[model samples]
Target: MSDQKPSPLSIGDFATWEPVLRLLWAGSEVHHAGRPARVAGRIGRRSWSLNLRTRLPSPGRAAQVEDIREEVDAVKRVRGALADAGVDDVSFTAEIQPSGEAVLRLLGPSPAVEPGIGTPYPGALILVDGSLPEPWRRLPDPVAGAVPAPSADLKLLERRLREGLPDAVGATEEEITAAEARLGITLPAELKVLYRVTRARWEDYNDDHEAAGRESAAVGCELFDLDALYIADASSRHCRWEFAAMEAVDTPPDAAVQGLVGSPGWIAFGDTGGGDRLAVDLTPGPRGHIGQVIMLSHEESIGAALVADSLTDLVLGRPSTRSSSARGQRPPATAWVTTASLKNVQAAAHPGLEALSIGVWDSAPLSLAPFTGLPRLRTLTAYPGTLADPLEITELPGLEFLQLGPQEWRVLLDARAVPRSLSAAAIVVHGNQDPLPVVALANEILALWDRPRIVQTVLEGAVGPGPGAQPGADRRSGGTPQ
Candidate 1:
């Protein structure tokens, strides 16, 4: 065996004409020696494309035209393969150089390609680079199937701090204060720094970054040492902080708590792990008080129970205290409910709730009457299914948004009912009852309302005339015109 290694090939190697000379010498068989080809260009903020080329056999002049046609078909196959692999925004164009030579260019981002090493006489070789172009920005949010973002509540932080600080030194407040007065020295600056930061604006830290910031602050100040005076100051500040013990108590299950006049409120519920249930309490005050309660319980049923219980405490004023943060304390009047079963719509537990979304656990008929009495209900959504009864949706004077899939569309059409209060609606039809009548019905409706924008007509067969029929024959009746 020869004691020599092959030279490495980069992406630029294939761009040259020398590769063509080498392949011609090796019986016109060219094999890709580098990564698969890709388009490395961008079109707009979130759009990108790739570039690729391949060689074709130099058959004699008689078959040269056929050879080019076959290569074009091969390029189409490649495009189809990329599309099947979930790649999008693709295009193809080719350039034929002098001397019966050709370059096929494919446009798209880093698309998927198979890996192999083989030689075919008078065949093309592809080279690819996987790097994205400059000015490429990160995706604003994680991909749908990727990991989820971290969620947290700041009120929980304050509550945990208040509960943990009192027992840190195991001494009475007077004793602690007397000792601090006699020491003639202020406690560590770190504790005071944290207390001030947490008190100033806890909402500023209310996100995935909260735990990270807290950890950094604690470690920087060396607060873990039991003998340190930092813990003493934190405890002292806790005893004096006005809202330190402002526990979020239960309220009536159906009480309308005012929120900021123009601010948006959101409510979400489902089984997110841990024993904690998420309850958002928005109360109206000088500004706004948005308190979130995390009730810990391993069972989902228990979590819902805790949410119901907390709402009762919050509404009844059983455990009431104002927050020192001037943002105010008020109950959220608008609640959006997402549940595993539509039956749990009542679990919203908010009286005079303004908005609602009911996500079904499975395909089942939904009854709109049960929810019709809602005084403030504005929006309602459910999975695709038949309606239990003929419902005049217009009865709900406040209804605004309604979404229905194919099955629900059939139900509404069969009942001969139209939603008069609907300002916006989406109707999805799965299959045609009969293509011709459906088309005619759509055309009739469009003509009646003089609204061409709402109807889209797609005809499947030939446009001009039927097979083996005269130009003016009536295809539907199989007869010549009168």
Candidate 2:
């Protein structure tokens, strides 16, 4: 009988999980009908169902390739979740279609859901907070609806932008043609996708890092619009025109920059609200290393900083750190980890240590004590099964945000030693049909969150498929807690 007061979970991670779910549902929602499932402890068989109801376009509206990819990705996530749970006898069937009733049924030795709302079943839920609620569920942004999104071609590219972006729309074939005709140089396919399919502002909101509103991301960096794209020469792309108009700046050594590459012929497209922009190196094909995306900023001495080698890296976002035992580059701000061995991480800890994500998996327990060495770990994501000791969190004093996996969070909360200075927390729940316990936990967290300093909290998971209060915004941004 351990009757100790529980500490709170930390919800301060920067990357989010909305992209997967958004891509999956397209424009549908689940409507639960039966009594919710009961919470089973760390034992017994587990079953869950995702009963999704989608609204097909009225009349002649059509589905696109991104929709198909989203559907497939949804199935992959389901299967991956089951396998990650380490279930011995896993069996489930999914009939997710373009129309009609769509269900994701699972039976496992155990598994993941949407948060706060409760799990669609009695197992785990794989959802995250901090993102604007599904765009379709909220009121349309005044300007978001006004943005032009002409799409006659690039169905796959269009779908991707729509799934992940707030007000994504694609460029017409004519628009793409006109830009290339004006630039004179043949635009790379990936570069065309970057500017044509969506608004490429890549604006970095320096003053408003905490601005989490749906449309706030557009306020900063000046991405090249189609009209700008047509007129700009090699010397003055996007923000470069402004920079080029100024004076000559000193350059730094290559190793210091976060997202730049070698040579000086790169064409700038997007930028940080300040002096840096994401560029494509024209020096590649000539130098036998073409098509790489790097960072070029006037603020720092570092020039040609390497970002990801290609556009695919934007989605996967991994630095080529050579092979095992060698230190790969760390992201300047965040590192999204899906798979990596302990040794690989140990060697790769020097660069981007601000925000790190260790993707959830049902693997053997590992110690977090070692990661305390990550000097700049402001935010860290933890899986319950991965930690051998929850108290290892106490060693770090600078930690600001803590993201916790289901049962493991209970252990941390039970220990009651979470640093009061920790500003935010994210908790993933293994949902059961019963809503009372889940609601009680969220309520309790909300009540106590006002202490030490009001903590930013995000509650999401498949808690209940039906209607419920969704945590509104990341508290750090001054949004009210739901």
Candidate 3:
């Protein structure tokens, strides 16, 4: 793909996808009229599948653009299609004709599922509307008689700002009130005081970079304008289901800051200039003050680091002395069964557990009895043949997302034991397994919810034979293969 953004391709037109389809056909080891060559892959707005194998870069050397330029260009066309369609990602399958004409089909998910993370397939099923992961649903513990830190000196902060920015424009009382109403939460006293001293708007700097730099230096961070102030809640931080489902919230009793994805009390008012957010924490941990300062790191998915005891201390260049670290290992919210990770299912069984993944194991197949009636368990994914009995999944009552092999799914479907509680599902495809059967199984799951089935749009177009187009290797590749 070009570094610069290109115009979106015609999503509904076959010509836009011919190049991509041709590339897939070229790379296929098996392509003939008697056998319909199968190609399956997913493409997202920001990511896509590059199934073609290219030479690995030499040691101590980065890959050159030419290494996978053809693959990147091929996937970029699909990305353009996603943009034109206004969907996050799309999973598709195609079959090549002997004359080089191809039959292409795109997968359309129902409204019941969120867009799958990094895949073209359907994401987590929404059995119930407005359903959220356990971590996102957590609220901070309320503290009685919580007081602001002694370092919170409103007068001193305002005085310092005024002295440093004599010609700066401050926000009016009405502007501050409007911001509070927009956020649906009262601004902390120190934050309000800081805003009153200087609104931190670009207009205040008159588009002068030097003036803006001076204000950032004076305030200790790139402060947001009054109108730009927003509540740092879970909704503000977008996390995909695959990762979000694995996370758990834990706040130690003695800690000074809550361990959460985002909190209602975290009022984002400034930037750390490195993509992280600076917020005034109103919902402080047990030992924390009412209005302490915290920095939400961009690189992390959950929790914030203590920047200072108070906003006043932040401006005054004082490091936070309060200890926010939790002492012991947190309850395992996500578990993996494999030789490299957790060795057994018993070790992972806990009331707090949410997502369980059974990877390639050399030991005997395991049972789901250990997770029976576990209140929080929502996601379960097992490698093919790792489960002793596929019917044992019925014991897990709260499963929302389940990924299992086609054989296991057959057991559940034949026995009429498919869980009614599932919000989303996936088939663990192995080797050169056919996708038609997998799609058939996926339709069965969607049928349970009365959701729309995945529709296949077949398009006929001639693109000639591919480079590696030959017989004998019927390979299937795409998505994060389970």
Candidate 4:
């Protein structure tokens, strides 16, 4: 309705997906002589999503199975189709008739969707353009009175670097200016001094491995060159919506670094050998110094740990006064509303809440009135039949991600009440259901966003009845067919 059209989803030729259907017909067990055998899978740019019965290799090489070499090759062939179609992922369902005919249906290339997590079904559907998770949208709080720490001495940092790497090449003023222009941020005084002492350029070392190692040791981390410096913003760190929606940002009063996904002022300067980043924090915490040093660990999703009070302390091998014990007082941002969890929506309703997952409920259905206008609430996932009324979803103004059962989505679709504020959405399927109808439902949701529809292709070919297992008979059992 907004006239916002998503990019085209190009459907590749039939030959592009044919080999996979052939492999599916050959690989799966045929359960009946009279009925068609069905097999379904999802394919992404890099990997294939195969079911447990498909029998691929396990981590321990323990699962019993047939040779999966051809299955892997077949998936690779379909990946080529994804590449050709210019989409990152797609899903398919194939039917092999007892009469040796086969039909393969390619489910998507929907620009609005992301690949589901370990499921044959699709993931979050991006309902709005350029929408990001709440945590990603949060900017660091400004500490107006913050000043450089006592240890932040640019002269001492340059002097220490000169003492250690006397033969190292430093960055020219023009090169530093060019880097600042490219990144659109001015380098801190201490950082500028460190770069001036040694640019950390490989060409400067004339391919000398020892020289690079010496520079790294002198800098107390693997220092990046002036040109390599970048702002560690939220856009720089990519996380899937399913996981990102569950995170919350909280900066403690005593923290030296702001608790954020990333910041425009957090200039990454080096790495701590084990894939962690060392950044100069211009957007410091409440009691923190303006140019404190923070380490962005690779393992965590949000926030940085104070590595040192300043870059001068880093080079001098001094520890930060801020301790990790001071940071765990924030309220829970994600809440689970279910029989086993919080018990009810009213119990989980809090101003700090960001995501709420409504699981299987044994009692009467619940209402959405408890969460009507909660400003920070962005994600909501309710199990099938748990909601008293699906139309209550319209009252949630800030919801960016919504996951409901197919029928709930249908209720919203028919009433034309699907929230326009949603950035992404999903249909939660509990039991075995036909994927065709589900794909159709997904298309309706995509249509609302003006996203390309999942192209359905019907291909017919001879696929002989798969080897010997009959309907109601387990081939491994020492019993007669029922």
Candidate 5:
């Protein structure tokens, strides 16, 4: 044996395994027990090695090891199958640990395999390790709650990550600055790092980008976690708070600021100027259930008011399970807008109204004439219940964003009337209607316009089972609205 000891490997060496494990678990019934699977290796090169360790349930050690070995053989067999099926340079190795768990390693040029290849076997533990590129490390953790059928479009992980920031943890300005001063280093760069990984989770749901502004104002110092000090500095635009993970503050492309500071991860900020920072903590509670909570704090005088306002806004924006009456009783409103409330407003005919989001209301036809006279009324979303010839949308010259329900589409199609100067329009057809009629109506609407930048036609089943079902049943059925 050589006298020199083996060089220690860096965390980057085992990067590929993370994505592979994510792919394996995507849409599968695997549970990640919170313990990170160990990985040791460099990816893509033959010399790179991989090791993964996981615990197996106690009952069947020998049989489990044999089954794991067969599973490894199955992966190798699948690689050969992919090659036979015209995929190239694909190879993998799998082995069972002494503890009756499985470890998988990709040996060469990574194969393009379907994300959900292995059939899920209950009670089997999975651990994957490899050396992958940095880009692979950034892949979002597979959706945690439940698994859907495998999709050929693996970019769904990317989509979820893009949608919003993950939960985060935050600290005050004085707390962070004191820590930095104690460390004898200026804290600008460190603060930026923490914001980048955890900012996206918040941004996806922010709707107006106001939360981003709030986050930047509050995160003023550096904090440490995962062996890295996440930096939050207001002065440096490059380090300005973002949702996506960042490697360095000086990286270019100003547009990336939104992604870096907003991506999902724990974040801490200093409240130097009395602004409150929001942080999400994803820690396990007593029974091993993962718990997430958001914390906000501001200075003594205005802090309480600011906290109340921010919390109210955040809570109201989220989808809630409580009834409107119950939710409205609280200090902040968290209930979905109701048709009765909307119609009541129209009946009252408030002169102050400029724009209305009528999409959520049940169909009740009201003439557009009253809205048209109001100089400021520029947007209307009406879902008139299953009735034809209720109102003429074209009468409103100032209308910009028009949302029509299935009944309205039928009326518009039958009348062969197309509105002029429409900036954007969305039409949703009911599930009860034959698909052919909806398709035909959509075709007719498309033909009426020339090069319209914003037009969408959706089928009812595609939107989810018609609202109003047993509690919790509705949750599983709804497809994302386009």
Candidate 6:
């Protein structure tokens, strides 16, 4: 299929180039891998479908049920992303076509009739009469003498990171500058250092030095290489074009359809091998942490997974990304992981202070004053407590959520001060406590909060016999279970 003219279409190119193709004519992905796979009947009203072959290396690969299933899974993920990206009804279908190539299908709005350029192929789009409308090659060149050199901080970081590499992974300032010009934007400062240091995966860095599958490195540092496309041509196609499409398909539910800013303005810079991406956020989310790194996973319930605000933080024990040294063992580097036992965290010397949660009896006192150094601490949840206190969490600078003993939180409501950063609080309300008191307290908490915040009561214990049953209660309706 690689040698075929017009060739078998790719799932990505079919989506991108077909819009350009629609300028001249209305077309749809009809079939693929020796069978009919039309999504017109199944697609939602606001969406379209693209059908083409799987982008596998070999021809007729989709004829195998395994390959077909792979493409189907890929399409489902892409559709879910589009839904989150605020693109309504952006779904797709695929099948093995009669020609033995997989056919990819996408269903969206009908293409507009505006004059357009660019073929489904790599080159610039052109008029039917052979006049150029858009480049078939790379983006237009940047004007001379206007491009900015790499920042000093970027250079210093690069120098510290570039140890042992003689040629510095073959990236040059000229290449990065050209890429910025083509994309019409400068990279974030740390990203500039990142690309300059290396564009290859750190795992693959020792491929040349591997002696019969053994691993070795000259440096003892725990830092891993970040993914970068330092070259202009790769960035334009992979970063600029393909990254936009990937983000569009994975738009967060809160974003607007017309003015969609995907996953809080994050752009893909590295891949996590599990279809998740590491990105640099251009538009800060409600957290107001700008230029921070985030993980975008189609599999994630909330699409954005906060990694770190900077690269240096990732390498240290602060906001460490998944590392062989830390992962699958004990306490994770940051607040991102969940563990069954707090003892494991203490044994690992990880503090487990950031976003800590534990099942503690209400009488047990949790002191925030002991961990005063952990400024990143944001959430604290303890349950089945007899009392709670706002003073326990008053000093946490980043505390956004607190769940503690009911008595403590109630007393906290009456306390002279509450943490300004405390945006949400959850507390256990024993059945013996009247609903009116806690309900009124919830209202007072909401009224006291200047911004939107949540106050929730987790009910426990039985009020004699339940309405429908004698013992436990249904979680949803708050009624007794049969």
Q: Write the residue-wise lDDT of candidate 4 on 111-224 in tens digits.
A: 667777655677777777677888999998988899999989878898999999999888899999999999999888999899888899899999999988988888899999
lDDT of 5 by residue, 1-482 (tens): 87743323211122222233323332122224423232222222112122333335568553465544533542343433333434333223322222213344332221211111111100100111221112112322322342211221224322332344343434445555665565444433223233333332343434645655543423321212322333222211121011111121111121111112222332333332345443322221111111111223432110011111111122223322221111122111111124655444345344544344443445554445555565544445555462224355666665544456656866766776546544444454433233233333443454455321111211111111213421112111121111
Give me the displacement of residue 18 in model 3, in angstroms. 1.1
Q: Indicate which candidate wins on TM-score.
A: 3
Alpha carbon lDDT at 144, candidate 4: 80
Give the lDDT ranking, best first: 4, 3, 2, 6, 5, 1
Residue 230 in candidate 3, Cα distance off native in Å: 0.9
Give Cα distance to truth, residue 459, candidate 5, Å.
20
Top candidate, metric lDDT: 4
lDDT of 3: 0.77
Worst 10 residues of 5 by lDDT: 119-128
List the candidates' TM-scores in order: 0.28, 0.33, 0.85, 0.84, 0.29, 0.29
Give candidate 5 regions above 4 Å deviation.
1-345, 357-364, 386-391, 413-416, 451-482
Show the lowest summed lDDT stretch of 10 residues, model 1. 116-125
Q: Where in model 6 is the C-alpha error above 4 Å?
A: 1-156, 164-167, 201-265, 300-303, 320-482
lDDT (CA) per prediction: 0.30, 0.40, 0.77, 0.79, 0.32, 0.38
Poorly placed runs, candidate 1 (over 4 Å): 1-285, 288-343, 349-351, 390-394, 428-482
lDDT for position 392 in model 6? 56
Per residue, candidate 6 scores C-alpha lDDT tens digits across 1-482 of 37423323322343322222221112233421324322221222233233334446475444555755644443454444444444433322333223322233332221111110111111111112221111122132222232212222454455555654444463478877875775556777777666666544444455554421121121112223333422222122322211121121122223211112233234566655566666665554332234555565545322355666555443322452322111223344233212344432233223444455545332344444554556545555555452233475666566555555556656667784555665445444443333334434444454555322222212221212224432222122221111
**Which residue pairs in model 4 clash with each other?**
127-423
- The TM-score, computed over Cα atoms with residue i paired to residue i, of candidate 1 is 0.28
RMSD values for the candidates in order, in angstroms, are: 22.7, 20.9, 5.4, 8.4, 23.6, 22.3
Candidate 2 Cα outliers beyond 4 Å, as residue runs: 1-50, 53-252, 255-352, 430-439, 446-482
